[model samples]
Every structure is written in C-alpha cells, then in structure tokens.
Target: MTASAEPTPDDVVSAAKALHALTAIPDHSPRWSNTAEPTQWTATHTIEHISDALLFYSGQVARRADAKLPVLRDGRDAPVSEHLDNVLSSAHVLAALLRDLAEERAFHPSGSADAPGWAGMAVTEILVHGTDAARALGVGLILPENVCARTVSRVFPWIDLTLARPPELLLAITGRFSIDGVHSDPDWWWQSAPLVEWDGLPRRRDVKPGWT
Candidate 1:
C-alpha cells in the first residue's frame, strides 16, 4: 500500500491460498462459516469466472513488451474442482512473471501497468469473486483490512487512503457500494494505467472543473 508495502508475487500467491480456504475442496468439508462478502452469481459460476479471468490476466502479463497477447483457454465448463486448479495454476504463473519483471511495463487496456498493478488486480479478482463463491455456499468471507487496503493501493490508486475501510471502501469503489454522488450508474471501472507518481486520493466522477 505504501512505498515500503508494494505488492509482490508473494501477495498474489497468498490471496490464492485464501481462496482455497473458501472453496472447501482440499478439506473435504463444508465451511458455512466463510466470513466473506457477496456477489450475484452462483458459487460454481463465480469461481469459473474468476478462473477464466486469472488465466486471461496471466496470458496478458506473460506477454513480452509489445508482443501480442496469447489466446487463453476457457474453463467455464470445467468442474468446479478443475476451475479451482486453473485459478491456482494461472495465479502461480502470473506470480512468477511478476516476480521476475514486475518493474517492466506492459500495455493493458491501451495503457501500461507496473508490477504492483498486476498483482493488485489479481488479488482483487480472487478476493471479490472468492467472496461471491463463499456466499453462495451459504458462508461469509471477510477479507483482511491490510489485504484490501493493498489491493486498493495498487489498482484503485484514485482512492483516498485516509478515508479507507477494509472491504466497505473496496466494495464501494469496486461498484458494489453506492457512494453518494460518486457515480456508478453502471459500475466503477478500475484504472490499469501506471500510477507511479499519481496522488493517492479519491477522484469524484460527478465533479467537474469550475462547476462546484
């Protein structure tokens, strides 16, 4: 979140492991006490979506500078177990690439992103979708404040760090919460551009220059 706490490959790895705990695959038991948040999709569908996203991001991150992005496989029809594996494998691959070349810049969505940006994005997918999966399983999964804060720091650098709360603010800027006058008629879109020197404060979409 701070200069000393920039996200790394290890951060992504740990978030993946947290997702594993939510799914209850390895333990072979139901964890109704998930303690996380919620989403609209079913558990199976949500997990599948996250797995595909993880794979896709891995593909983009693995691309060399100026290299074309690779086509990734769709695992939506795979069993939930396989989807879980896909999530973990892709996360590991992304982690390795980020670990090696985190500082190297690459184009994503017409803009370049640094290593922390990638890592934060991956963690966001896991934590948010993982919470959805957990909730559909009749459990709640609350993310740690530090993890949520770090994720915001990376992807949503526009957030004001001073007015932060763990999942509440995370969900708000992620379009899950309705912040007054902030604007999310559809949903809040996170920026993927390099934000190395940008001010870490909330940006209001409805406010305009010389209007207020």
Candidate 2:
C-alpha cells in the first residue's frame, strides 16, 4: 500500500455518499451474499453494521469538535441493526466535521486500534465497511480512485504487514478494501509471520470474525 495521497474533504464526502447509496438497496435480494458471521447476518443486518460504525465514528468526531477527548465504547459485539443505525448517523457527523475543519490535525484517542488520524480512520472505515455492506447486498459500489489510493497509501503506516496478507486482505481487516470477491469467513486467519521480514512493508494480521 502507498502512503502519499491524502483525501480532501470532498473526497470524504463523496465516499460517504457512495456508501449511503449502496446501502439503499432492498434487503431481500439474492445478490447480497457476504457476511462476517454468516449464521448471524442477513442483508438488513449488514446495512445495520455500516450504520453502527458510522454512528460510532461520528460521535467521536462530535466529541472532538467539542474539544473533548472522545472514547469509543465497546460495541464490537452489538447487534447488526443497532450498529447499522450508528454507522449511518456517524457518517453524517463525520462528513460535517470534515466540512467544518478541513485542515484539522488527525487524531486517534489512546485506545483506538484501527486507523490513526481522523481522515485516514474515517476513510478506512467508510471504504472497507461500505464494501462489506455492498458485498453482502450484492451491490457494486466503486470508490473514487483518489480515495482508495489515498487510503491504500496511509493504511500502510498504521498496519503491520508481516502478517503475509495481500494489500486487499490487509485492507479488508482494517475495513478499507471495498471491492467485491473478498471473503468474510470468520474462521480464516491471515498470519503476519511471512511479511514481517519484508523491507518497508507494514505489519498486519488477520484474526477471527471476518468483515463485520
């Protein structure tokens, strides 16, 4: 992954819009197929997960805007529907924050295990989770080249590539890879041992509970 291009506020907004549009698809279609926990999710549940992520991030942005250090409560195991609403609401908050502070420095509270800065983190989640939702719904949503390029670039620094995973696989773990055909099996793990010795490569690992 490259780390040169950084998305402008417009890029972030565009990505969010694309995600919302993709999630608008009807829930009962046969096209939707991927699921993090296949036995637990349907098309509706996938959208809900996206919504949940959006909500969580948006709240963080809001707290930041208020000059308060934002802390994300544990919602990893929350139901997909609850998380879906969160994702939607959070996307709106994130977009608003981008618009309000275009040049704000990136922030990652102490416990954030995901992306580091605000823009990078937002782009990562929107791009990756959006892809997950789209894949589950069997909808084809294309992220803007610039957004993906920027994300692919920035993602390298925060990740540990030694896990011996492909760029897409790493992105899938971080929730940035949005293209189709990526698997969501929770049991499959991509170990980072092989990629550890590669020069200049970021460290990454694939654990249980695939895309959610």
Candidate 3:
C-alpha cells in the first residue's frame, strides 16, 4: 500500500504482471495439498480462478460502450502455465482498454460508474485474490497499502478504512471477516458499479446465478 491515490491504468497492469510473476515461480512445488485461505479451492485452482476472473473483468471493460456485458467463461482444465499466460494477457488488454476509454461510462452488473472504476475493481481482484493464491502456496505477498486503500476508497466507500490496516480492511469489506458481531454472508456486497434508478442500488450479484 505505497500509493497515494487511486491507481492508474498502468498501475493496475503492473500489479497484475507482478502477481503473475509471483504465481509463476517454480518453487511452489508442494502446493498441491494446500488449500487457499477462506476458500475450498486449492492453490492451483485459485490461480486458475484468478486468470478466469481477469477474463471476466476484461469482458466488463471491453463492452463498456455496449448496453450489456459480455459473458465470460471459466478457465477450466487448464495447466498452470496456460492460466498464467491468460491472466497476463487479459490484464494487459483490460488495462489498455481502460486507459483508452478512461472517461467512458459502462454498464457493469457490479455497477461501476466509469471505466476507471472498473479498472479499480480489477486491481482489487489482483491484490486480494493474489494473496489468496500466495497464502495457499505458503508464500507472502504484500500489495502496497496505498493501492489497497485507494481501491477501498473507490469501490467500497462505505468501509471504515480507519479501523484496520489496509490488507485487513480490504478483506473485511469484501466479506472475509465478521467484525463487531456482524456476520459476512451473501448479503454483504461491494459497491462495484454505480447507482442508477434502474439498478435500484449497487450490490453483488447472486451466487445462484453463476456469480462465482
């Protein structure tokens, strides 16, 4: 968290590349038995999920000018190398798209108000999910507190950032913890998209409908 403000498009792309490099390291040989933190997915499965998520995010930005979001598919049955490559490629493409259309407003199910906000969500995904994969691999990776803080400020503005460290705060707002007797569950949602009359309010999509 070394950044001072919302991360630029370039920062998002750079962080994603760094994450890919971390997950691409060859020494995590025994992670086959390790389960990712707070999830049933294994280390390998988590990495693949990260890549698949990047594609999903990419589709969100790619269709910024369209009324509907593109349907993205899972990265199933793919090897580690292939997953890493897809993540790297998708990150770059999404970053470039955001940079080029920085001012464009998009309709995201997550409710992003602008193109850059969607990019912020992508950055959050990299830092948070990257940590998930790394922890499962028994490694430590710290995203800059500033970047993490900026993401919280942008997407989850209702979160009380002063109450915890950047990483902990990020996890807390994302429903990774139950603070002060408040339980995290499907009702807990991030402010991914912007508010609109038709949308009612910005909320996480239902898991029953392929939200995972």
Question: Which candidate number maximizes TM-score?
Answer: 3
Model 1: what TM-score? 0.74
Candidate 2 TM-score, true structure as reference: 0.54
* Candidate RMSDs in order: 6.8, 8.1, 3.9
Candidate 2 lDDT over 56-109, as tens digits, reads 555655554333343444446654435544555566567676566543332333
Model 2 CA deviation exceeding 4 Å by range: 1-4, 20-24, 28-40, 65-89, 99-116, 158-212
Task: Write candidate 3's Cα lDDT for 1-212 as tens digits.
Answer: 33356556776776577575455556447774478777777777766776666677667667764554555566357656667677778788887877877667666555544754776677767777777777777666766666677776666665566667766766665566446533345444556554232344335555343344
Candidate 1 worst ten-residue window by lDDT:
203-212
**Per-residue lDDT of 79 in model 3:** 58
Q: Assess the local accuracy of residue 19 in candidate 2 as a C-alpha lDDT between 0 and 100.
A: 64
Superior candidate under lDDT, 1 versus 3: 3
Q: Tell how far residue 100 is off in model 2, in angstroms.
A: 3.8
8-37, model 1: which lDDT tens digit per residue?
777777777777665554333343224334
Least well predicted 10-residue stretch by lDDT in candidate 3: 193-202
The lDDT leader among the candidates is: 3
- Candidate 1 wrong stretches, greater than 4 Å: 1-4, 25-41, 65-70, 178-185, 197-212
Query: lDDT of all the models against the reference?
Result: 0.63, 0.49, 0.64
- Per-prediction TM-score to the true structure, in the order listed: 0.74, 0.54, 0.77
